[model samples]
Target: MAGAEDAGERADRFLAARFDGVSRSRIKGLIEGGAVTVDGATLSDPSLRVKAGQTFAIVVPEPEPAEPEAQDIRLAVVYEDEEVIVVDKPAGMVVHPAPGNPDRTLVNALLAHCGASLRGIGGVRRPGIVHRIDKDTSGLLVAAKSEPALTGLQRQFADHSARRSYLAVVWGVPNPLAGEIEGDIGRHPVDRQRMAIVARGGRPALTRYRTIRRVGSRASLLECRLATGRTHQIRVHLAARGHPLVGDPVYGRTRGARNAGADAAARAALAGFSRQALHAATLGFSHPITGKWLEFESPLPEDMGTLLARLELI
Candidate 1:
């Protein structure tokens, strides 16, 4: 079965639901790149409706290994051993090398810290990486030293067995105290650089959040968790719910506080917040080799603390 679906179902969604391990974006990329064929005819439109009993073929590109080089960069190592290394990643640090950012990445620093102990996981570029956080998001990150450790960590993340928590200052209060945001996230139909909440042709993403403190009408502090990991999951979910971050230029910008008739001290403090207020606060998982549970936490970055202090929420 080519994963038969309703006659009016979108082509991209049909293929993604039928094929295990393929992301909705990957499927859409295939369709847009003319790699999807319906009954041997190349299909270019991802939203094209499929008829019942139609067979479609989606060709996925084989990713070539990235040849990343190590640079002499300083890394704040929190913990290290034969199997794993934990580090406090500062804001503005790219987790790994990619196009436009060829050097000065966490991978380069890890290469320097671990030397040849970094085991290649399927590629030279993604050495020792089981998962990753967004650039500009500060927090604790774990890197693997051995192949077995890498495999174990990957399994934990894939099964959602790892305990991961994040802290963020959003634009408004998230109602219901504690609740879940279950939506399908997919690439925006117009903007390729952004993700959107969609009804069809997207993958299911789940984010659980609890309100920690309300930071006036401008924002609120939140502790968030991920039941399913997708690109920009937390940011997208919050923005969709009408509560963008204070300094998140990508999703929505915070209005200037001049309308609120704030005092000089408040204005000066608000100007200091320039980056998206998000941080990975805690991570826990089973030890790859020792079978012992390991957990780590990162202190709030200076920018976050400064924002809270200025707002008198600390």
Candidate 2:
């Protein structure tokens, strides 16, 4: 409960603030489980309006144990060592299991490949995972197989020492060609599913972008480097600049090819595109256990390559 000060706010919003490490979806789960009550009646809705002075009682259950089943999934191994493993993750592969994606993740693959050693190294559920790239954004990701590697990699990520570069095809060509995007990113006010630039209660984010190739005057290929890693940082920052990546479902234009001055073939291809035109092209970090500096680069996926080919000839 948020007391009397925040009377009219949505229940999920205030509950999210009050409950640390609990997401809005988790709060809805509590509401569904009859864990929230007010005035002796259980609240069944997550959107209940709270009048001033009405107290809400909540019962939060203990976190469920995370035990993911291993599967014989194929992995595109980039580089591997006794302490760490790097894989060039294809688009559409989840790094770890979550609510909607329960199994068949990178964790499952790692478990099947590494056996018991992969468990309890990083954390439960997502063992051996360090950082994450979005499922639709293909790229290179490194996972630690031991405690020392985990701790070292976590420290590097916390201090923003890990380097990540992404390649994106935005709908419009930016005027400056190359620059930095600085903002405070947080949950969108109205749309909880998306991140946005907010004035308060946001983490500082920075993205540096340079134009690699111009797809005519309306679209361009860019290389974006991250100084800070926030959820959807590159996508949000580029969208905020009015140059959202092509085929981005949440933060991009639907008729982007028309805006890109494309011909009929290109426009049809753009319309048929399924995922964001972004890829994690490069990654660099110090070896967690060996103290060796390591870097890896991935070529654009076939889909992005085909999309670019269509746009370039337009």
Per model, how many backbone clashes are there?
0, 0
Q: Write the per-residue lDDT of candidate 1 for residues 1-314, one digit (tens) a residue.
A: 34344678888888898899998888987787677899999887788888887888877766634566667788888888888998888888899876445568898788777777766566553458877888878898888887788989989999999989999887656788789998999988866568889888889999999999887655689999999888888988988887776567687642432333155655565686767788999989999899899888888988999887776631
Give the range of the ten consecutive residues with the poorest summed lDDT in model 1: 253-262
lDDT by candidate, in order shown: 0.79, 0.82
- Candidate 1: deviation at residue 9, Å? 25
Positional deviation of 85 in candidate 1, in angstroms?
1.3
List per-candidate RMSD values in Å.
8.7, 5.8
TM-score of each: 0.74, 0.80
Q: How many times do residue backbones clash in model 1?
A: 0
Off by over 4 Å in 1: 1-66, 123-126, 254-267
